[model samples]
Target: MTGFVIRQLGPADAAAYREIRLEGLERHPEAFGSTYEAEAALSPEEFVRRVVEVPTFAAERDGRLLGLVGLARESGVKRRHRGTLIRMYVRPEARGSGAADALVEAVLDHARSEGLDAVLLAVITEAEPARRLYERHGFKVYGVEPGALRIGDRAYDDELRIRFL
Candidate 1:
C-alpha cells in the first residue's frame, strides 16, 4: 500500500475506473447493484462523464491502477447535505492492506470539501469484513432491508450505514 498514489480521478482516468469496476464485478458478482456485463458496454465517453462528474478517487502503484472509490452527492435541494458512497473496490492482493482505507478516507475528505453533512452506504449483511471496515471508519449501521438484492435466486439483506461528515 505504501508508495501508492491515491488521488482524485480525472477525465483521463475513466479507464482506470472501468477496469477496476470490471475487476470488482467479476470477483464479487453479488456484491453490487450493477452487473459486470451491463457496465462493460458503456461507451468511453459515458464512463468518462460519470467518473469525472462525481467525486471518484483511485489508488495507483508503479503506474498501475490498484483500487478506486466513488462518492455521489445526493440530488435535489432538500438532499444537498447528503451523499452516497458506492463503487469501492480494492484488488484482492491489496486487501488487508491500507489501500482501501486510503480510498475511503479520500471519499470522506471529498464529502467534507463538498459541504455535505453526511455520507451513507449499504453493505450486504453477510459481508462481515466489509461491515467491520465501515464501522472502523465511523459508519454506524442504522437499518437493514431484508431481501434487498436477489442474485441468482439468492436473497441478500442490505445493511445501511451512515456517518456525519
Candidate 2:
C-alpha cells in the first residue's frame, strides 16, 4: 500500500466518513457509544452536519479514506480548557500502517492549536493495543468506569486517560 496522509475532514467527506464509521461501530460494538443501526438511520445531512461541527480527521491513501478520529471540545465555562478525543478507528487493513498513530497526533495537534490545556479519551479496558498507543503518546490512566458500555449481555469497562498539553 502507498503512503497515507492525515487531514481534517469536512462536509464534503460525509459519505466516506459515514461508511467507515458504520463499519467501526458494527465491527467493534464495545468500542463506541453509538450503535451502527442508529447511525445508519441518520440522514445524509446529519452526517454532513457532524463533519462540519466536529473537528474530525481522516487518514486518506490514494483518494480512499482508511481511518478517522474526532475531537470534541468541552463547552462548560470551567471545562473549556479541555477537549475529548472521540470516535477513533482504523480499518483492519490499515492496522500497523501508522494510520492510527497519525490520526492521534493530528487530534493532539489540533488540540494544541486550539490552546486547550489537556485532552482526554476513554478506551475499552480490554483494548490493549489502543491503550498502549495512548500511553506511548503520554496519556495516563486517570480512572476506570465499570460497565461503561453494555451491548447485548456483555459489559465493557473503560479506562479514562488524559494527556496534558
Candidate 3:
C-alpha cells in the first residue's frame, strides 16, 4: 500500500488487467454491467484492444496489479465534452489501501487532460461504499436509474453521479 504506483495501462498490461477485471465481474456480479461469461469469452487480442482504445489506469504494487479504472470519452458532437468512468475495480485484498481512491483520481486527472468538462459514472444503488468513494472525490448524485442492471431474477438500481472538472 505504501509504494503503490498509479499509471496508465498499456498493451503490456492487458493480461493483468484482464485477470483483475474478470475477478471483479465474477466476485461481484451486481456491481458491474458486463457479465463474467461475456468477458471471459473475449480473445486476448480483444483485451489488448480494450486497453488501447479506452484510457485505462492501473494501480500496481511490487509489480502486481491491485486495481484499475477506465475513462471513455463521448464521441458525439454535443457529448464530446464529457467522459464516463467505467470498469472500476480494486482487488479484494487491496481495498482500504487507497487503491480505489487513487484509481478514481487518475481517471479524473485524465479527464482533465483530455479537456473534458465533466465525468460521469453510475454505481449500484446498494453499494454504499462505492457511492461514498465517488462523493468523497467531489461527485454528486443527480438521479437514480431504476433497475439499471439485472442479474438472473434480481434487479439492481444504479445511482447516477457526475463531477464537473
Clashes of each: 0, 0, 0
Error of 1 at 56 (Å): 0.5
Backbone-clash count (model 2): 0
Query: After best superposition, candidate 2 residue 2: deviation in angstroms?
Result: 4.4
Worst 10 residues of 3 by lDDT: 1-10
Q: Which segments of candidate 2 are over 4 A away from where they belong? A: none
**Which model scores highest in lDDT?**
2
> For each candidate, what is the lDDT?
0.88, 0.95, 0.94
Task: Quote the RMSD, in angstroms, for model 3.
Answer: 0.7
Q: Which lDDT tens digits does candidate 2 get at residues 1-165?
A: 449999999988999999999999999999999999999999999999999988999999988899999999999999999999999999998998999999999999999999998999999999999999999899999999999999989999999999999
Query: TM-scores of the models, in the given order?
Result: 0.96, 0.98, 0.98
Candidate 2 clashes between residue pairs 3 or more apart in a chain or in different chains: none
Error of 3 at 19 (Å): 0.4
Judge candidate 2 at residue 152 and give its lDDT: 87
Ranking by lDDT: 2, 3, 1
What is the Cα-based lDDT of residue 11 in candidate 3? 95
